[model samples]
Target: MTLHTAIVKTEENKISSEEAKKFILSEQNGAESIFVGRVRNENSGKEVTAVTYDVHDQAVIKSFQSICSDAKSKFDKNASIFLEHAKGYVSVGEISILIAVSSAHRDEAFKICRYILEEIKHKSPIWKKEHYIEGNEQWLPGYSLRPKEEIK
Candidate 1:
């Protein structure tokens, strides 16, 4: 069967920009929106050297599928897309995640791309281990799970 979209590949899989571009362009569409998540050199006030990503494998992939499925339902059509995340050690300038969406119109692509990226950040089971300048690293907590009811 022809894949409607791809939400496969776990933490061990690495994605390239070329792959994302190809995935988004394969289908004949008028427009596209591509979002690339990359590793930067700073987080909070710390100077980051690299970021190690980890995921609760099954949950991460499931979350990705749900995103794609939801987009299709909301948009009422299949969008050409590539959803990828990484694991192991990723240094600065490396791609941590990539999302590309192609639709008949730019609005659909942009809307879906934005929705996917934001939702993934808020909902995915992936965590980040950030390496700082002083030779220290720390694993981050998932922000979406913060109990707002307990914040008070």
Candidate 2:
């Protein structure tokens, strides 16, 4: 398969890089790019204790597939892509997102990896609530549902 995508429930399961690597590996690929996004200890001047990800599962999955397919069309058709995002409570240092891409060239591998990430950020229905060390939590602003042309 050229694409694999899922939303992993952080409470029971964690995103694994090894699995991503294994999935995207192919004899046809000459370059591999993997991106691991972790829940940071700080965000916007606050000490972040953890993060909770809420997802519209069906929409997110559909978007992931579309995004990966678009990336392949735009870059390399033979590219293999693996993408997974976390849901539920994710502690600091835990993974929030993982993307792995393998292609025939380094440039295509890198572009596909980055394209998947950026598209997910803008198009996926995933929300984040950050927990601060001072016993406060706030839902951060996510991507606008409006079309890009209509936003201005």
Q: Which numbered prediction scores highest in lDDT against the true structure?
A: 2
Measured with C-alpha atoms, the lDDT of residue 107 in candidate 1 is 88
Give the local distance difference test score of model 1.
0.77
Q: Report the lDDT of model 2 for residue 130.
A: 97
RMSD value for candidate 1: 3.0
Could you tell me the lDDT of residue 82 within candidate 2? 93
Where does model 2 exceed 4 Å of error? 147-152
Candidate 1: tens digits of C-alpha lDDT, residues 1-152: 11233333434556777877776674557888888888999888889999887777778778888887788678737677678778678888888888888877888889988988888888887888999889988988678676789786
Error of 2 at 126 (Å): 0.6
| Model 2: ten consecutive residues of lowest lDDT | 143-152
| Residue 88 lDDT in candidate 1 | 70
Q: Could you tally the backbone clashes for each prediction?
A: 0, 0
| C-alpha TM-score for every candidate | 0.84, 0.95
Which pairs of residues collide in model 2?
A: none
